[model samples]
Target: MAEALNAPTETANAHAESFLRDACATLDRLRAMRPAFQRPSAGKRIRTAFDLADECLGISVEKEALLLRQALADRQNLAAATSAALLRLAGLEMGYRRTRGYPAVAQSGDWLQNEQFVARNSDLKKWAESALYMSAAPANWTGRIAQALFGLAAGAAMAFAVAAAILANRWFPAESIPWAILIVISYILKDRIKEWLRGGFLRILPKMISDRMRDLIDPKTGRWVGRTREWVEFPAPSAVPAWASPLAAGEFNALRREIPPDDVARYQKDIRIQAARLRRAHSRMNSITEILRLSLDAWRERMDDPCERLRFVEEGRVCEEIANRVYPIGLALRFSEKRQGGRHLIRRGTLFVTRDRIARIVIEPTPEGGIAGGGAAR
Candidate 1:
């Protein structure tokens, strides 16, 4: 009996060691491929990450085998080893995806397979539980509260408008205008008016919110830093100028004739400034065009029914598509806070989604004394 127990114990230990060794080797291979895997295309990077995930699943199967052996041996060491291996694998997967510019929400679904593996192996259950708890934590309570308040205010405004419309028909207009007609007109006009107000508010809201935030003074120099808002509008693709389009070259040439030869440098500088603005505008337009194209593709795939698709187009859901695109790709907002060696900070209430999409905005300091946005994938 003693010899039989010792034999199984030795076998379990060997299996555990082998499983760990293979897991590490797989991770090493992934790291080795990272350098050559650098690609400009987001789709290609996502595919590569998926391939890495498949390899991870293979490793997990081997881990499961070791877990079974450990259970047979009745050793606590097996659970510890399994937890460490899973955590390490998860860390590597997250790091690899992030480095490749994959959004957290996009990669989040891939973890479901890992979760299933954990479910089969009791050792990893604690890690899964902890992850759930951490994810559920109310880290962005301020954002949540602000969103709730905005919803409530919008509801209240609509209610008041309806009530006022009914009262006007009753008290002032009397029998001239029917209460039903008045209410219907008010409802229709209210949406149009709200759209107009929202457009104007959005134009200035960012600056207003930034002003209310704590001034970001340079930690080293204590100098006041000014905030600059960079607005890049993405109109329809047709609005964008052609790649080789002339940038007021004819006008510039005409102006050159009026300027003295000594002032040619200043004239050229003005032309350069205008040309740069045109280029920036074209770039933003192209980006938005691509984003809309992708979003439309996603929408079409989601709306399979012919009637549903037609309804989407007829209802002018392009605005919703634009919102979805912006939620994921995010709008760029550069600030001068980083110029003076201070961290970039935005007031929590300022960032918001235009539509009902579950997106969280993340701002990271860039190397060029600006901030970059990382929004959750819708």
Candidate 2:
């Protein structure tokens, strides 16, 4: 009995340590390749190397989560051990970031169109561990099927209108003047019909069909397991949820006096999995994680300089300091699983952004919910 209980702890520790070692090794390899990536023609090579590294890092993180759960269930006192491992992992990320010189490399002409793949290594790994399921295709392909289906429906509506007009002309032989008038009316109505259908579909599709569908594949079995939908909207201050508005308000109140109400946005992604299908597809698989990354490049286009001059007096002497100016974007995430008595988890955080990139993120502890920002990273 003692040995059986000890087995889980031992196995979990082993897996966790293995992930740490693998991550360290991967970073070391990337450090060695940094010099090669500095060349002008190294664009393709850079993408290939980073893409592989990202995928491996994502997989390692997911496996670690699985092990972490097992260890916790076994009631092992491994908090310190796990924290140490995670701290080391973060250290590796910082070292890699400095070694790569992301700010310099990102400015190169060859890095165009590929900038999104870099600089978020740490954030990606953090989210990957919590992702509910891995996307079979790249993130860009998530909502493609739904888009094509809607477009097809609109096109079919136009085709049917054209067919009906021809049938009416043939069935009733009218005068030239009447026929011309009929054709003009048909043309106007055809466009209106298509646009009306498209507008209505756009409004209703969010409820009926997900933004993403049928693309999530099980990594182990290479079979379909689940699907997901995502939404992004810029809501008015009055429309913000009561629970979340206070969090956003507190963030702005500390930074600036007057808040710009128009800039606030909300992002939500929903994942639905057929647990029975997942169990049948892979017996060992019980959890899935969705890793979502948002790019702030567009937001940085019109940003002011990264630093500003601030003057003050200290000890009866005037002094001036150039402080790095950072903008705070309030963020709140809510997670709830579809089950009886399932608890809703809301984690609040603020993203501090500089003119060039994200400086840091500070997540507050949720006193109400038992968990922290333990949900899959977005």
Candidate 3:
């Protein structure tokens, strides 16, 4: 019975391996035929190859699920190994497609397979990456509640002020000067009360709420793998952290030789992952990758022209030169992983940007604070 259950998984594994070998050879053939990709037969051929690759993964994943229902002792371990193997095969196919210039050069090559290949690549990426699903939302519930409370307090204060004025109107009679004085005092106090509460609440709001919350889910096992909370603040130059300032100023002030400007923003992200839960949910998964993309559309809009002309005397002759203009943006990063006994890593980098897009990024050498983990600091 055990062998009977194992036979399907073994066959699927062998088929997947065989397909990987053939897929590599097919890709090589396709790359060599780049010049002829304009032909309809070439597109059809490319489409057929990827179709088979997708079918191979689909069948393998379904077969691997069977081992979970079996009473065998090593079934979970076997399933994990099989899943890892399939994921590796898919990843390799995707990587080779890029390095060999399959789709990247297709636009200029005018390959008929361009659209199909893009769609196929996106599908393969999701399958090979993992079963993790993520969603993020603004974490402003506390802010809303605080706003409601402030409104109520303001309304109550104004109500009391109006009530007192009404009572004083009867006591001193509206026609008298004393009644007029009491009304003036009540109006002034009402405005002051509203402003005072608003100022206090604004100061306390940051400590009370995060900007956003993100949750990670394992779709396969219906379990949560991790969570993250992020905060963003525009701190004054004087308020920038002591450690971050020196690094930014060291590189930023080199060009102008002046004090660092006051326009500084601080962003922080706290991530908590359940290592044990992730392992249980996805035995093949080793680590999670987080991508942070900062949009510079506003900065780009405010930039000067991408290039400027300069006139200089060269060899005693007047000559004009047009040079590309670029600006430097400094970034100081500090990361802490409590799991590694509170290990810390610091990295500094500068991004050179043209008016249109980022040109390049240059990073300084790592400092004495060793990296928390074995992977490269991204």
Candidate 4:
């Protein structure tokens, strides 16, 4: 009877300890990325850190889900966290794409697959417009034009040679034999001239020049280009998808795996005030994500510059890649939501707040218009 009573206490202690460890790990991860948060304003700084967190979480959640989805019936907690974190976070942001706009919204997958994350992934349009490729253009086009001119120049020069041979009239019955032989020789000379001009002279010459000239160029990824900052507001919470709701357990747990052990350990010493801390963290996360939305949008704008040069003037392929990279990631971060799960699942994993994945935060305000989130409800 005593053992049974103690078992409950032991289990609670273990879970509590685990929770504390998890919290500490998350904070440490955030701190480790402190440089990512350094910006002009506190609000901007908050948003930058929050974006970093969101991206890291995106890797964790999808990878975890993929492993579990594949594992099917045989699933466990530690296995879930470890496997998911490895799969999602492993080389995740590194695989991120770049483009000009945010995706529609993605409820699943890592950062690379989403179309909206812009700078997170590399888009073909951006690549084509990049300064490196544009730098090669002037030389390439010049070589082609020279190659054509070579044909004309060789024809004219050879015609002169034929006339010289005809006038010399050195060979046979000065009538036509020498002229005919000269025709053969002149044709041969023309072939040699064509070969020399097309292969080694202007045609090949400009490639070297192009390589040198290519240095002073910047590639634009879109139809336009420039730099500026402005905030475009998101639709109110209702319009966003359920999966995007920050408080939904699935959405919450979605990034649980990325929360590290060291950060979790720090939280253990202060577990007593967990409720308050969680509230603060939640608000912090909300503020950060909001900033991320704007930042990503800003990044999208950066990619919109067009490459008017000969290299990337064809814009189709690059545009598609950008769309793929940015669209879904933006959607997942701002508006998508996940499905509901059982009670235990609620405590163990993240929940989406909306169908399209947007989360809602209820903000409380001081008389001064300052915001606080003291209440436990999200």
Candidate 5:
């Protein structure tokens, strides 16, 4: 009875230790390859990393188990070291996933184009409105009015001076002086003396507004809300500024053309495979952790009371089943058969190991139908 109780606890510990050793070795291998991985460009480095991850996924369970057994037989206490290495690798992979910026090829081209157009038009409208307002009327109406009034007062004062000059001297011609005064009065009321200054101020105002609007626009989508650009004078395509050539020019055209249909298909397939492998790894890690926890609990229970051997053995069997069960290649499977080309027969099904030592497949029912298991059948 004592041997029977101890057997399961010992087996669980050995298995956990073996798995951790193998994981640590894998992490070391990845670390060794880091320099070579970093040699590639950003995009290429991501592709290489995915390829390495795929290779890791392809490693057979039998080989990993054999390696772990050998390492354990050598009597190496590497559990803590292996666990630390595994955690480091996981952290690195997670950081890479977070920071890697792939081109938005999978996104809808029409949507992106629409957003770009909307943004461009919005900016154009704002510029047009600014230009029109600046050209049509002064922005500082009060200042303009004040200046006009000042000019009128000056003109009136000059007129009075000219009349006084005429009255005080016979040399000053009254007819010519009256004509010149009339011209000065007309110029002051029209505010034509300050026309050049207003024009300069208006140009600067539109530019400042344009700079602000450009800052607000999204760099990727170029979309902005409000206003229309029907009247805005957009620059000719050929006259694109050097600074804006990357954005305003057809820069994406070459990139788009470079990515053929076959490459796109291949990329999508690779992404799916990588995603599946990553999810599988994550699930396997969780299962391993649960197995260890269950094993430790059973061990502790056995230590507390010798009579609980049977219960501990039973719990150990459950942990062994969980550890030994092969996780499904794809975590989730969706039914392909559709009703009236609308709803699927089965919504989706996930593969999970039940506590009762059974691989239970739970499927969600489609709105149009009850529960079904046709995903694998299809």
Candidate 6:
């Protein structure tokens, strides 16, 4: 009887050891995952992941056995990397969707254009707005900062140069002054002139960017989708800018005018409106006919592979770019940002594919551009 009892005790001990061994193996496998724990102190480092075991669920899991698993994960596996990348992307979208406001979250369709409005442009538009722009939103400054600096510097420099010449009495008899202290007067005039010209251009730049971006992305049809040839107000046509050639003077109208849907009364529906529009009427006249004006932009990108990515921002240049880009091949996405007050809002605009890939998108302005509750129109 004693011998039999001892045998059972030994067997029980062996079973316990086997259980412990399996647990250790499982723990080691989890450690190989290289899971990155989310915490306030670690900044925003993204890490790969796997379907955490049930033990890893719940907020406090980080301090639990689940935490133990994450702590042990290996950081360099394909599966783990993919998970981390996805999480990071998802986090970005959440942040953007929040800042872009309710527009991106709108229901499928409503008084405003559908949430997937880009779906309407063309195959190229599709590749652009949806894929390219989305992937490149954080690449650069919006060009607003540099433009602001240049304008301010140009204005200030003119004012100072005038003041310096008058004070030093260098060149051009200072005594010829009608009032002797005319330097101050000229400085004021110079300052005002510089401001007036530069300010107008700056303000118009955003509007231009918005309009051209919309057309390239939307390319619908409307009254305003026609292209205009560059105009030169020549005095007897002696010194016309090269851009003012007769060939450049053609309206070169786009085939379509894309406009946004009017959704102010859309609360009855559960949709958010975008700030833009497109015209669908000009699809056949010419590919450049798109209201979103994407085709033109693509053409321009191809034409000017300029440094720092800041050339040909004007609609005309963008249109030309689109006209030229796709004729060749390969896709190059561009990204930028604009600052307002103390905060910065990054925007990703692109010359991409539309549904059938006709070439561009053009949207119409709804007076208010479908902005709700005092929101600015696109």
User: Where in model 6 is the C-alpha error above 4 Å?
Assistant: 1-50, 53-137, 152-179, 208-378
Best by TM-score: 3
**Preferred candidate (TM-score higher): 4 or 6:** 4
Instruction: For candidate 2, give the lDDT of residue 266.
Output: 78
User: What does candidate 6's lDDT look like per residue over 1-378, in tens digits?
Assistant: 122223343443343334334544664565455444444444443321222231221111212222222322332212344334334433443343446342332234473655343332233234334422211122123355547656775867586757766664764565675445566666677777677767766666653432212112223321232221111111333342222212212233222113432111100101121223222432342222112222445445445323222246575555223332222221211111222222222222223343234354333222221222322211
Kindly indicate the candidate among 4 and 5 with the higher TM-score.
4
- Runs with alpha carbons beyond 4 Å of true place in candidate 3: 1-133, 137-140, 155-180, 221-226, 246-262, 309-322, 338-341, 370-378
Clashing pairs in 2: 131-288, 131-289, 131-290, 132-288, 132-289, 132-290, 133-288, 133-289
Please count the clashing residue pairs in each candidate, in the order shown. 0, 8, 0, 79, 0, 98
Give all TM-scores, in the order shown.
0.21, 0.53, 0.61, 0.26, 0.18, 0.21
lDDT for each candidate structure? 0.43, 0.64, 0.65, 0.39, 0.39, 0.35
Worst 10 residues of 4 by lDDT: 263-272
Best by lDDT: 3
**Tens digit of per-residue lDDT, candidate 5, span 1-378:** 122223454553455555656765765676566666666565785756554453333233323444444444345433554435434545444344335431211124688755754564455445433412211111244445555655665566556656555553464455677656665565464454345445555555443332111112212233321221111234454453332232213765667446752110000000001224333434442221101011224323423222222223564473222233322211222233323443323233444432233256655443344344434221
Q: Choose 5 or 6, whichever is better by TM-score.
A: 6
Please give the TM-score that candidate 6 achieves against the real structure.
Answer: 0.21
- List model 1 lDDT by residue over 326-355, tens digit each: 222323322222233444422112122323
Q: Which ten residues in a row have the lowest lDDT in candidate 3?
A: 64-73
Q: Model 1 lDDT vs. the true structure?
A: 0.43
For residue 111, what is the lDDT in candidate 4? 62
Per-candidate alpha-carbon RMSD to the true structure = 23.9, 13.4, 14.9, 27.7, 28.7, 26.8
lDDT by residue for model 3 (124-192), tens: 666555435454434456667777868976996799698878888789977689898888888888888
Cα deviation at 73, candidate 6, in Å, is 45
Clashing pairs in 5: none
Q: Mark the 10 consecutive residues where model 2 has the least summed lDDT.
A: 99-108
For residue 181, model 3's alpha carbon misses the true position, in angstroms, by: 3.6
Question: Which ranges in model 4 have alpha carbons more than 4 Å from their true place?
Answer: 1-28, 31-53, 65-69, 72-378
lDDT of 4: 0.39
- Which candidate, 1 or 3, would have the higher lDDT against the true structure? 3
lDDT of 4 by residue, 1-378 (tens): 122223444443344335334644664576576565665565775765455454445444434344433443132223344444444543343344112122322335666545554444234234323423312122245446665677677776677677656655755455576667776777677677666655665545543333222111223322211111222223544454343333436654567545741111000000011234334434442311111212334435544232222333355643222211222122222121122421111111222233222233333221231222333211
